[model samples]
Target chain A: MKKTPLNQVHRELGARMVDFGGWDMPVQYSGVIEEHLAVRQAAGLFDVSHMGEVEVRGANALAFIQQLTINDAAKLVDGQVQYSAICYPEGGVVDDVTLYRFNGAHFLFCVNASNIEKDFAWMQQVLRESALTDVTLTNRSAEFAQIALQGPKSVAILAELTDVSLDDLAYYHFCEGAVAGEQMIISRTGYTGEAGFELYLPASAAVAVWQKLMAAGAPHGLLPIGLGARDTLRLEKGYALYGHELSRDISPLEAGLAWITKLDKDDFVGKAALVAQKAAGVPRRRVGLVMEERGIPREGYPLFAGEREVGFVTSGTMSPTLKLGIALALVEPAAAGLDGELEVAVRNRRMRARVVRPPFVK
Target chain B: MEFPEELKYTEEHEWVMVEEDLAVVGITDFAQDALGDVVFVELPEVGTVVEAGKAFGVVESVKAVSDIYAPVSGTIEEINDDLVDAPEIINTSPYEDGWMIKIRMADAADVDDLMDVEAYQALIAEES
Candidate 1:
């Protein structure tokens, strides 16, 4: 298993470690609910170093990315970020990524850890096929260490550590700054639906930066968050996890990402298929479900509308914030209506569930 | 971290307090610590028959769901209804308020087959 730069720090903090997508990551430190609540009410810090970063640079960077990703990368200005996905020719998702545009000639793609190798290889192959002479692709996954400081108190905690005016950093925007005396890319973006910043620094400077942030955040009760709470926080906001909500066989439109999939963009991968699918209408739609019964719905649990099996849950949990059994399921479009009643087969018995719009907590 | 000296323990991490012909059952502190923030619990109804070494109910945390095993064969006489609303009490007070069920023991001798506090501590130490 691959260990992040903060692996020892997590172990020292008494975090429960788990194998997450072949990476040794902390699943929880204090506890899932407590850490989750801390992020909701106060603030939480997270080690997100395991996520992959790929740099696409050169004269054709904008053109290359625009053709490679589903979103209109040409719309992104320097220092701006766009949530986008790479799709196969058939319209199924390859991976959802965050495109960080430094300039027309330099772009950074932050992808999921599990899809690093696959996405990198795919990009290389596509670039080779496109015959883009000026473009250069580099997988810089191991060179960076990233941390997310998230919550209502996130800005205040981060403000104590850096001279950068965080007030000026708009959402989905980034700036190069010095934090804890180390050069880092501070981005006002996070998976958790909170006012947060993701700081990307050199791998060797991770420990010092983490300690400085921890010290600064301690007075405000900033707990070190782990993957367990991270999952719940994102799910509460209806954020799509790569493997669960978006997959090789799942189209972005079906995954509630139609807004990001720009069909009007000229000749991107999967454009034709997505256009056809949009015209035909998607067969399945992702919907939020709150369990009416006591059972916790789990991934792969079958969903039924009346007696007909409609779909299966993609991600489900006993929501720490809502105190309810909430889940995300991809069901037949007809069964995805709000307030519609559905049954989830949990532990072999059908449990009552109601279709509701996410974010489940808010 | 605490293991009551009077209670007997199962290898699966359940604690049983033998009281005459009945036994009050709950998970151990070590078990609760490992489970992390119990969010939901599914308990068997009173009068439900449970067999020794078989799963009787489930204890769910935010990250994982675990089965609570029956330490001794018996019929459930009572259950801790308080756990259904605030399952987190299992993390705060695993041995006392978090007790899952009380069973009318089918055989009093089954308690002897289980490990005492000292033996249970040794078991935990060996695993760690």
Candidate 2:
């Protein structure tokens, strides 16, 4: 299995290691709930170096990205980030990505780790079919390492290190700045729905940056979180994970990403199919479920309303903050479109659950 | 981490303490440590018959749902109902308050099939 640059550091911290997406990564440190609560109460630092990055540069970067992704890259100014998805021509999702626009001519695509190779190949295939000669595609995942410092105390802890104007760096915006004596892309962004920063640096700088942040954040109770808490934290915010929420057969609209699927824009991959799907009404919709009773809903668990099966759970977990089971499920739009009661088959028995909009904690 | 010498152990990491025909059962400290932040536990109801090596209940951590297997064939005489609402005790006190069930053993000789503290310790060492 592949290992990130901080594998040794995680081992040093005695984090329980697990195989995650073919990578040997820490699943927790101290414990999942404790580390999760720490992020909510104070601050938590995460090693996000395993996530992949692709650099797209040249004369027609914006146009190439606009055709390649679902979101409108034309709207992105320099040093701005846009949450986007690359879709199959048939309207299903190929990969969800975070597009960082350096300028009209240069851009970076931050993609999910497991889909790195596939995403690059797909992009290359699209560019080849489109016959765009001006665009350059480079997989830069191995060249970068990223870290996220998130929570209520994030600003205070990061203030002790970086010279960047965090105030000016609006959410979803980024800037090229010096942090801890190293040049890095300082972004006011994170997977956790909290005040945070994602620092993108050279792979070689990962250890120093992580060590420095851990030291600076120690007084503020910043814990080195692992993949387990990361899942719960993102689920708490209703963020769509690539494989779980959006997959090759799951469209962005069905995954509750209609806002990012710019159907009104000029022709892009999957736009025709998405527009047709919208016109015909989406067959299924992604919705949130909070257990009204005792059981913890798990992935692939069937959901029902009365005798009719509505859908199945994509991801579910016990919310560390709410102390209740919360889940994201894809269900028949006609049945689960409204906020109402549903039953989740936890195993042998059906458990009472209610459909609630996400951000389950707040 | 703690292995009481008087307790008999199963390879599945359950500890059984036999007193007369009745046995108190709970997961080992190693099991709870492996399943971090246990959030919910589902135990068989009283009077339910169980077979050895079969899954009778489930223990859920934040990220996974794992079955708790029966270590010996018997009927569940009593269960730790407190675990329904406070499952983290499995992590905090797996041996004491976290004891999962009491079984009226079908065959008292079943206890003899289990390993003692030293053997259980070696088993966990090999597995880990």
Candidate 3:
């Protein structure tokens, strides 16, 4: 199993370890609910070093990125970031990624850890088929480590270590800055809906940076969170995960990512199929369902409107904040409207659930 | 970790305390510790017939859902209804208030096949 730079740090903290896509990672430190609630009310830090990074450069980087991702990279200015997706020609998703544009000629792609090799290969294939010799792609996954500091108190916690003015860093923007005496890329974006920052630094500097942040954040009740709470936190905001919500079999349209799909933009990978799919109308819509009964809805559980099968759950849990079961499900369009109840077949029992849009806590 | 000497234990981590023909059943301390915080529990209703070595209920932590197996064949006499609303009792008081069910045993001799405190401790030791 692969180990991140903070593996020993997590072990020393007595975190519960689990295998996540071949990486031996911490699933929880204090506990999932504790870490989750702490993040909601105060602050939390996360190790996201397992995610892959790809560097794109050359004069045609903007053109290549615009031609590759579903979102319009042409709309981005220097130091701006865009959330986008890469799709197969069939309109099935390749991966949803965060694209960072440092300049017109320099950009980077942060991709899911599990899809590193596949996403790189797909990009290489697209570059070759398009025969854009001005574009260059480098797999820099091993060169960097990533950390996320999230919640309402993040600005105060991070301010203790860095001189960078937090007031000027807008959401979805980044700057090259020194944190804890180490120069790194600090981006104001996170998977959690809370105001947060993601720090990208060299792999060797991870331990130092993590320790410094932990020490600075100690007085604020900031906890070192793990993958278990990460899932619940992101799910609470209705943010889609790669495998569960978006995958090769699921399209950006079906995953409710139409805002980033940019179908009207110049021809990109999978545009024709998406155009056709849109013309035929989307078959299903991703919606949030809150349990009206005691039973907890789990992934793969069937959902029904009356007696007709509408869809199935993609992700679910008993929200630590709400103390109620909430789920993101792909269901028929008619059921997306919360006018009536939907039944989730939880094992042998059919439990009552209602369509409630996400951000389930707030 | 507290596998009582007077109680019997199963390899699946369930504990059994025989009270005449009724066997008091619940998950062991080690099991609850491994499961972290218990968030939801589903127990069989009273009068349901259960077979030994079969899954009769479910226990869910925040991250996982696991099966609660029957230790001995019997009919359910009572269930811990408090667990449905306050499942964290399993983490705080796994042996007493966290007890899941009481079964009127179809055969009392079933306890003889289970491990004692010493044997259960050795089993968990090997696991850890």
Candidate 4:
């Protein structure tokens, strides 16, 4: 199992450790509920170095990215990032990644940890097909450490560390600056659907920055959070995870990620099919369902419209904020209307659930 | 980690406290700690009869769900209904107010199979 740079710090804080996608990471520090509530009300710190960062830089970097991703990379500004879906030729999603336009000739793709090896290999194979010169693909994931300070007070805590004013950095924007004399890239992007910043720096300087943030932000109630709360928090905000909300069989259009898919852009992998799907309207879509009965719905549980099984849950959990069971399920578009409810089978019992939008808790 | 000397423990980490002829049962602190936060509790009905070493209830946490086994065979007399609304009490006080059910023991001989404080501690140490 892999351990992050802040593994020792997590242990010292009495975090409950669990194996998360082969990384021996903290599942919780105080508790899932408390840590989750803290991020919603105050601020929480997360060691997210487990996410993979791959650098793709060459003279034809823009051309390579345009061909490799389903979204148009040419539209992104130098300091901005765009969320895109990379796909196989058969129109199935390989991975959902954030394409950061560092410069004209350079870009960084932040991908899910579990899909790192597979995504890297796929990108390399695709890179080989293009005429991009010296398309230097480097995996600097292990060399850099990332910390996400999230919630309402995150900007205040991070503002004290860096000289660059965070006031100018809008949502989804990033700035390269120095924090505590160490070089860092601070992005205003987060998975928890809260105001926050993801700071990336050298692995050697990770622990020191963590300690500095904890000490400086302790008075404002910044807790060292874990993956358990991370899951619940993201679920509340309706964020899609790699294995749960996405898979090799799921397409970006079916997953409600068509906003990221720019079919109008010049040629890209799976663009033709995606544009066709968009034009024809996708038959199956991912939607949110909230249980009205007394049972907690879980992943892989069957969803029924009357007697016949219409769909199955991809990700489901009891919402801490709403005090109700909610799930994301892929159902036939005809059965996914906002006008009615469905039944979700939890174990032997079936619970009444309403088909809402993507975010049930939000 | 607290193990009352008079209480009996099951291998599944449930503890039974005998008061007269009735036994009040709940999961151990070690079990609650391992399970993290308890989100939902499915308690057996008040009049349901359960067999020794069999599941009588279920405890669902944020990540997974686990069956709560009966330490001894008996009819459930009472249950702590407060856990239905606030299951975190199990993590805060697993041995006391968080007691899951009260059962009238059908046979005292079933208690002999359970572990005492020392035996349970040793069992946990070995597993850890």
Candidate 5:
């Protein structure tokens, strides 16, 4: 398994390590609930170095990105980031990514760690097929380290380390600056649905940056978060995870990503298929579920409406903040109405559940 | 991790405190530490019968879920109702207030098959 630049630092902090998508990452430091609550209430630091960074540069960068992603890349200004997805020809999602626009001729795509190699190969294949000669694609996944400082107190803690006036860094905007004497890209974004920033810097400078942030954040109740809390925080906000909410078999339309899938835009990969699927109406829809009974709903557990199996859960947990079992499930569109009665097959019993819009906590 | 010297242990990390024919059962400190923060617990009915070494209930944490096995075959006489509302007690006091169920032993001799404190410590050491 591959290790991130901060692997030794995590170990030194007594983080419980686990194998996450072939990367030895910290699953928890103090505990999942503690780390999760800290991120919601105060601030939490996360080592997200395993995430992939692919640079697309050259004169045809805009054209290449336009043909590749589902969202309108032309809408992005320099230093602005957009959440988008690449899809297969069949309209199934290839990977959901964050596209950072540096200029019309340069862009950076941050992709899920598990899909790094596959996404890079796919991009290369598409470039070759399109004959886009002016565009140069480089896989810089190993050259950069990313850290997320999330929660309400994140800005206060990070402001102590950098001179960049964070108040002017609007959401989804980024700026190049020095943090702890290391050149870094400070992006005002995060997965935790809280005010935060994601810092990207050279891999070799990860330890120094992490230590400085940790020391500065100590006064603000910042905890070192792990993948375990990352999942919970995202789930609470109704965010989609790659393997669960999307895959080669699940279209972004069915995954509730229609906002990002601009069918009216100029021709792009999967546009026609997505348009056709939309006309036909999405057969399945993703919905949030809160257990009305005792058992915790888990992934792959079947969902039932009356006596018929409607769909299955994608991600579920006993929410640490809510103190209730909450889940995200893909069910038949007709059966996904809010407050709809449903049941989840947990263990040997069918537990009662209710359909509700997510952001379950807020 | 603390293991009360008087409590007998099962290889599954359950601790049994024998009082004549009744045995109070709960998970060990090591087990609770591994499970992290407990969020919910599903307990069997008080009158339900359980088999030795069989799964009787489930203990859920924020990240994972585990089955709590019955160390000895018996009828459940009582359960810790407080855990349904505040399962985190399992992390704070695994051996005392977090006790899952009290069982009326079908065979008192079943205690002989469980490991004593010293043997249980050795088992944990070997596994680690």
Candidate 6:
């Protein structure tokens, strides 16, 4: 199991550890509910170094990225980040990535940890086919650590350590700055449905920054949260995780990520296929469900409309804020498009639910 | 992992406090801690027969769902109704207020299969 720079710090705080992908990460510190509520009401810190970072640097980096992803890379200004999906030739998503346009030549694609190798290889193969010159792809996941300080109180806590004026940095924007004498990239972005900053730095520098932030944010009720809260927080906002709501077999249009696809962009991979799909229309759609009955729905559970199997639950959980079971499911266009009652087979019983718009907890 | 000296334990991390022919069953501190924040718990209904070492309840957390096994075979005489509304009690007080069910023993000799305080502690340590 891989350990992050904050592994010992998590242990010292009595965090419950679990295997997240291949990394040994904390599931919770005080508890999931407590840490979750802390992030909603105040602030929370997270060790998100397990997320994979791939650096692409060369003269043709921008042109190369534009050809590989479904989103328009030309639309991104330097110091800005754009959410896009790398799709297979058939228009199915390989992985959802956040393209950080650090500069004209230097770019970084922050992808899901599990899809690092696959995306890296895909980009390399695609780059070789293009006339884009001197493109270099490097996986720097092991060398760096990323921490997210999230919630309404994030700016107050981060401002004390970093020289960067976080107030001016808009959402999805990043800039280089110094924190406790360590150079860092701070992005005003996060998975949680709250305002926060994601700090990216070398592993050694991250340890010191984490300790300093923890000590400084203690009086402000900044809890050191874990993946347990991270899931609940992101689920509340209906963010699609790579393996859960997203997969190699699903397309961005069907996954409710059509906003990120740019069809008008100068030819890109999967663009023609996606443009064809848009002309024809999507087949299946992702929708949210709220259990009208007692039981909480879970992933891989079969969805029923009375006795008929209509779809499968992709991701489901008991929403802490709503105090009800909610899930994201993929179903036929007719079944998902229409407003109707559905049932999820939970344990041995059927839970009555209603199909609604996503971001269930929100 | 706090194991009460007065309670008998199973290797599955369940604690049973025997009072006359009735046994008050609940999960141990180790079990609760391992399960994390309890979001929902599916408990056995009253008067339902349960077998020793069989799953009688489901403990749902944010990460995963875990099965709560019965220590000794018996009929569930009463179920803790409070947990349906507030399952977090299992995290706060697993051995006390979070007592899941009360069972009437089918055979008194079945308690012998369980471990005492010192033995249960040793068993937990071995597994850890």
lDDT for A47 in candidate 4 is: 96
Backbone clashes in model 1? 0
DockQ of each: 0.83, 0.95, 0.77, 0.81, 0.80, 0.76
lDDT of 4 at B109: 80
Weakest lDDT window of 10 consecutive positions for candidate 4 chain A: A127-136
Residue A54, model 4: Cα distance from true site in angstroms? 0.6
Higher-scoring candidate on lDDT, 4 or 5: 5
True contacts kept of each: 0.93, 1.00, 0.60, 0.80, 0.87, 0.80
- Candidate with more favorable, higher DockQ: 5 or 6: 5
Better of 3 and 5 by lDDT: 5
Runs with alpha carbons beyond 4 Å of true place in candidate 2: none
Chain A alone, TM-score per model: 0.99, 0.99, 0.99, 0.97, 0.99, 0.96
Model 3 C-alpha RMSD vs. true structure (Å) is 1.0
lDDT value for model 4: 0.88
> What's each prediction's clash count?
0, 0, 0, 0, 0, 0
Docking class of 2: high
Candidate 4, CAPRI quality class derived from DockQ: high
Q: In model 4, what are the clashing residue pairs, if there are any?
A: none
lDDT of 1 at A32: 85
Query: What lDDT tens digits, residue by residue, belong to model 1 across residues A1-362?
Result: 99999999999999999999999999999988889999999999999999999999999988889889999998899999999999999999999999999988999999999999999999998899888889999999999999999999999998988899999999999999999899999999998899999998999999999999999999999999999999999989989999999998999999999999999878988999999999999989999999998878989999998899999999999888878899999999999999999999988589999999899977
lDDT tens per residue, model 5, A57-168: 9999999998999999999999999999999999999899999999999999999999999999999988898888899999999999999999999999988888999999
Q: Per-residue alpha-carbon lDDT of model 3 for A1-362, expressed as tens digits?
A: 98889899999999989999999999999889999988998899999999999999999888888778999999999999899999999999999999999998899999999999999999999998887878999999989899999999999999999999988999999999999999999999998899999999999999999999999998998999999999999999999999999998888999989999999999999999999999998888899989989978899999998899999999999899889999999998888886468999998989999998777767
Cα deviation of A54, candidate 3, in Å = 0.4
RMSD of 5: 1.1
Give per-residue CA lDDT, model 4, range A1-362, as digits (tens).
99999999998998878898899999998988888888888899999999989998888888888999988888889889888889987678999998888898889999888888999999998888765676788888998899999998898888888888899998988989987778988898998888998888899999999999998788889898898889888887777888888888888888878788787888888877877777788878888888888778888999999998888988888888887887888898878998469999877778899988866655
CA RMSD per model (angstroms): 1.3, 0.9, 1.0, 1.5, 1.1, 1.7
